[model samples]
Target: MKINYSPSKNAFYEEEHKERYLLSGSWPGDLIEVSRDDFIEYGGNPPEGKTRAPGPDNKPAWLTIPLDFVEQAKAENKRHTDEANNYINEQQWPSKLMLGRLSDDEKLLFNKWLDYLDALKEIDVSGAPDILWPTPPAEPAS
Candidate 1:
């Protein structure tokens, strides 16, 4: 079977170590090899290429990662997201829904986060800002 990197995953294997790079926990797992077809599909770059390998053309252009490592990384990421979502629901949601609206201090904090969320798509997982639910729309004019 061929191993392809999960697009949803934020971690990868460094060609230098020939081991998976975990963005968080360094869990142990069995080593898995990638098939030639899968490697070609991933556009894997050969390690060191001509300078170190048999030659640039002779080597593949991708690195392989352990299958178990991929699963572990995905699970860890999910756990983090779930915890953050729960915190937002419990801590931030009620504050936002209060009848009188947020205090100046709260509003400032929320707006800052709103701005940050607007820029979140471009951020890496490690750099992502706290979860910020959308603010309610302003009331209509009298």
Candidate 2:
């Protein structure tokens, strides 16, 4: 089994089901080969609340997930909630539905978005990279 570095995952794939990277062939990143001992010691995936990154001289090293991650998550969640609120409140979509201007499906979609926005606002990013983000109504959120 060969270990390949995945910067996006911030960790190494000890065997990395080839289909995910080799077949897709779209993940552009480093190709550092890690020894089995290193993999065993540091783990294929970074430890909880931490991430892998290139350290001195570009060698793989484990680093704690930084405080910036919390701030970043807060900003992202705010952006999503703001957008959703704009559609529901600022745009008066619910009023449109009440006035028979919108379809039932659109109202349902907006309702789901309302729940998703509330979930986003309640997220606790104190865990930084360990945070579990809420899913969006129509798609995956950051």
Using TM-score as the measure, the top candidate is 2
TM-score list, all predictions: 0.33, 0.49
Residues 116-141, candidate 1, lDDT per residue (tens digit)?
44543332332112223333334235
| Candidate 1: regions farther than 4 A off | 1-61, 92-100, 107-142
How much does each candidate deviate from the true structure in C-alpha RMSD? 14.4, 6.7
| Candidate 2, 18-82: lDDT as tens digits | 56766678554665777877667666656666666776645567777787897887787788788
